[model samples]
Structures are given as structure tokens and as C-alpha cells.
Target: MDLCFIVILLTFDVKSAPNPVNIAYTSVALSLHTDLVYMESPPGLQLLHCLRFDDCVEGGESTYLDLFHVVEEFRKSHPRYFQILSTIPATFHKCHYDRENPYHLVYQKPHIILNHRKQVVGLNWAPPFEGPLLVEEDDVLMYYEAYEELAKAIKNSDKILTYGMKVGDLMIFNNHRVLHGRNEFKLNDGIRHLQGCYIGIDDFKCKVQVLSNQVGDGQPPKHVGNQSWL
Candidate 1:
């Protein structure tokens, strides 16, 4: 209902080695906006920094300074403000399916334990959808480092409300547009994972238009090595 900006930060260090997450995110943000804040570290840590501060091995200081970089890819893509946010540690568990694979619940079954007591809710799925994949909330994990950036973006975006997100999956969206989220998840056995990125809607529209033109010309979209057109 109102314009907003979100910035999610992982307390972990990101300036030690090459940060694949920041490097990859820098590339994406540059596509959408040009006025980005580049990390101040040397080029060696371009894509090898740690994302989840709570999830990496310690004693890797000089090799793991928390370096944050912003790029033009984020600004030119959209004409709005971006915000950031953060999430505490959480765990996800595997899904338990029925004989017919009819899911007992979708989304995530987030749980928490205190004093050795565990709490939970009945099975619940999300988005009112069905697919061949039997994705369980437990399958989620806080795996990727780039996700903390993405989450921060979502938190500080204009007119975007992320319902919360599952860890581990790659969820892509427009940087300056669109909304995203994940159902709440549980914490048992200590596993959390989430991964994602942002793309400009203009770029996506261009790709779709190109694909449509190709199809109209009686040619399938170009393919390489069994992969769809990039």
C-alpha cells in the first residue's frame, strides 16, 4: 500500500575470497541500475565471500571480511527505492507424502523447539498449485549467500511485500518491480537454505518477444547443449 525499501544483511564476512554471490549479484544489479555501491575489497574477493555469517567456518578473517557491493545493474532497471531486511536462523525439514503423493501440506511447515519440546502445525501447501515435484518445507535450507542480498532488496523495495521465503531454492524476480515471499518454516536438525536473484522486467519482456517472434517464424527458440535459449 505504500512505497518501501528493504536491505537484508548477513552478519557473516564477505570480503575474504572471491564472492560468487556478490559477484553474481553485482552482475544482476548492474543490469537494472547503474549507480551501485561496489565493494571496497581487492578484486580477488570478487565472488568468494561468505553470505550467512552464522554458517561459515571461523578464523578466516582477512579471507572473510564482510564486503558489501552495489552496482548500476540495480538502479537503471527500476525507478523506485529498494529496502533491506534480515532474518534469524531457522531450519527446514523433509516433506512426508501420502501413498498417492497427494501432499499433506505445501509451502513450509516451520517449527521451533524450546526446552526439548517441539511444536508444529497440520500439513499446509501454498499458492493453490500442483506440480510433479514433491517439494517439502524440510527440503529448504539457508544455502546461498546471495539470498541475504535478495532478501534485503525485497524488504526495502517500493510496493513489494515478501511473504517470507524458503531457503535453498532459486527465486528470480524483477529488481525494481514485483513482490515475493515464502511461507514460514521450522527448525529441526539444523538445516536452512535459500537462493535467489533479480532481473529487469524489460529484459524479460525482450526475451519473451524474441521467443514469440521466433515461434511465429516457425522456428523453436534457440537451444544449446539441451538448455533453453539464454
Candidate 2:
């Protein structure tokens, strides 16, 4: 991907006024969500580099949840709800003003995406951008109930990891399989800034393949089927 189009530098500081564009621009706690759920094909890999983290700052711990495990647990406990969420499409929208390019983006996709073998592979869940009910009236209640259950599980799950990122910390994760958020923070003595960039999964995979071919014998591994790339 072109560096000019793929990189996004993010600065998290207390703004004078609330920006309706994104919650990350504010100091409030951001809910656990997958980035760009409003897009049909969201970025695959996310990289965050912390440039500044003052000791005076409080409550700015980063949290991450593994959606793959969450979905597995949900399927075991609430099979029907899992089925509904995996099949029904929900609409997500983002309408914000940009001086250079104002935009309103919308997309419809099931909260859980499955692979050809019916295995959960991707997810799209963002409460902030979730649009109005797209399902029938009869199914709305069930949908919300399932949604609420899932949300609660994500928040209360013991697997969630919280880390206070320090200066020079770089965090990278698979955007498709992980849900990320941050706690409400207060900037007292210094500023908090983070630079970020996205790399397409295909590009990353190609690089890995090239490296492997250059270093390995010309034959594929015999245990390839047992290996899980994701």
C-alpha cells in the first residue's frame, strides 16, 4: 500500500469541544469496537506507536479483546443468538464533515462473518456507528437482546487485557480478529500522542511468503494443513 494513503497519525488529547466524528478524538472511554466496521472491506492489520505518555496522565490504559475467543464462547453458550448474529445483517453508518472531503459512509454486514467451512473468521461491531434496526419488528427484540448479551460479555470477560502504553511502545494486532478500546483518560501535566498505520492483510501475507520461499527449501511443509496462519 502507498504510505501516503495508508498511514493515519492519531493524537489523543483533550479537545476544547466534543468532536462528533470519532470518539478517539476525545478523552472519554471508547467502547470496544472493530475499526472501520462501517466499511465493506476494513483494514486487516493495525499498528499503533505511542510517541508521548506522561507520568501525570491517568486512566489511559489500552484494552484489547480477542473476538475469535469471544465468538467461540458465545457459540457454546448461546447457539441461537450466535446463529442470528452470524446470519442477520446490521447497518453501520458514519457521517462526518472534513474540510477537504466531507463524507457519509454506510455499510450492512452481520456482526459475525464466517468462512467457507462455516468457521467464524471476521467481525463487525461498533455501537457508535450502528444504524437503526434493519430487521423486521419481530426480530428486533431478539437482535438487541443478543447484541446486549454480547456487549456485556465483551466488557466483563476475564480475557480482556489492559495496558498503560508508555512512550516508544508499539502495539500491533490483527484488526479482523481483535476488538480494541481505551479507558477514559485525564491529561494533567503533558500531552498524549500516538501515530498509527494500516497494512493490508494480503500485502503482509505476500511479504511473509516471499521471505519463507527465500529462506526455505523449494517444497511446501508437510504439516501445512495443521498450521493456522490467522
Candidate 3:
């Protein structure tokens, strides 16, 4: 019908393949990570609508965590590691041909992003999608150490949330601020299906600002993953 943006909807279905490439389509657990870090600006907001999740499914609970909250604590404890990750650039790539169409995307960015005042504002920390590390000789060792420490901190953080999705469940979250993943599940003769979409940070925040002025909703600006340190 030509009604909406192309590639606007991404479907997640648990099915078997001769050699499954995409983990989202396989019945396996996924580590926590952000989506499409290969893009210059990864999606800001993510929406998922669960169309079917049978009651008999063994274990397919979705999980999420606020990276900002974790980063705040990491900065307090490992300030130097945080700074290293923020300054050193890491490469993220998406070169796959498993689907009907091929994808060859690449982007380079620091795992952490900071503003002039050195406050952590944004991040591009997706391990599964990470490409080769191409940096200066000195930064090679330093980046790995810092990256390892940050990963350990993320694993030790206790702020992660878990939820089991049911039919008709619609979930929306700030993709930049939250890391998302799913646990491996056994179908047990049942099926699970989920559809997802993304809203650009620029567009989403523009609407919020315009509406705030139009309706006189004087609430302060909320940091909804637009790289604002506040």
C-alpha cells in the first residue's frame, strides 16, 4: 500500500534454519545490547508488539537495563576507564547476506559519548555487532582493558529488569538508554511472534518540544536518549 517507511517493521519469530544466522529468528538466548549501532545514529525509541506468545513457552522472558544508570555508577568508580571508553573509537559493522536482501553497514564510534563538561550523554556499546578494533598501537591495549572493565561493571549491575511477553503486549523504551535482550526459550509445541519498529531521536524529540509549547505543558525537558547528560 506504500503506507509507511520502508524497513519500518522488523519481525522476530522463533524458527529453525539449516544454518540460522540472525539470533532473533532463532530460539536462543541473546546477550544484552543496543540495536543498529552500525548506523551513525542508532534508533532512539524502540517499540515491540507481541502478536503471539503461547502460555506453554518454557523460557522467553525479555530483559532490559538503563545504561545511563550503569554508566553513572561506573563513572564514579572507574573514572579513567570511563574516559578511555568515551574517547577511544570502536568500529561496528553489519555485513550479512543471510536474508533475501544483503546488508553491508559500518560505523565507528566510542563505546561511550560525553559532552563538553565530560558527562556521559550517549553510547554505542553492542558487542555482537562489533567489528574489528582499528585504533592506534597505544590505544589497542588501553581500549581492551577499559572495555573489559566496563563490560564487567555492566554484568555486575543489579538494575536490570525482566518481563515475560504475552499476546497483545506492546513495549516501548528509549533504545539509547536501555539495553535489551531475550532469554532462550523452548516452544513446547507453541509459537512466539513479535514485531518491532523504531522512531528517530530527532523526530521524536521535535514532536515533544512542539507539543509542550503548544499545550503549555511546562514540565522540564526529560532526557529521553537525545545525548543530553542531564
Local distance difference test, each candidate: 0.25, 0.75, 0.81
Query: Rank order by TM-score, top first?
Result: 3, 2, 1
- For model 2, the stretches where C-alpha displacement exceeds 4 angstroms are 1-20, 98-100, 212-230
User: Across residues 1-230, which tens digit of lDDT does each residue of candidate 1 receive?
Assistant: 32122223222331222234332222121111211112111011011222332232222111110111121233234212211111112222223353344323322211111112211111111111222333344432331233334434434545433332222223333222222222222233232333323332334444555667776564442211111233
- Model 2 earns a TM-score of 0.83
TM-score for each predicted model, relative to the true structure: 0.22, 0.83, 0.88
Per-residue CA lDDT of candidate 2, range 19-125, in tens? 44556867789888888878767776788888887788888888998878888899999998998898778899887776346768888788987766667766787
lDDT ranking from best to worst? Answer: 3, 2, 1
lDDT of 3 by residue, 159-230 (tens): 888899888999998898899998999888888778788877666666666677789785545656567743
- Assess the local accuracy of residue 24 in candidate 2 as a C-alpha lDDT between 0 and 100: 80
Clashing pairs in 2: none
- Kindly indicate the candidate among 1 and 3 with the higher TM-score: 3
- For model 3, the superposed segments whose C-alpha errors exceed 4 Å read 1-21, 216-222, 228-230
Cα-based lDDT at residue 126, candidate 1: 16
Error of 3 at 110 (Å): 0.2
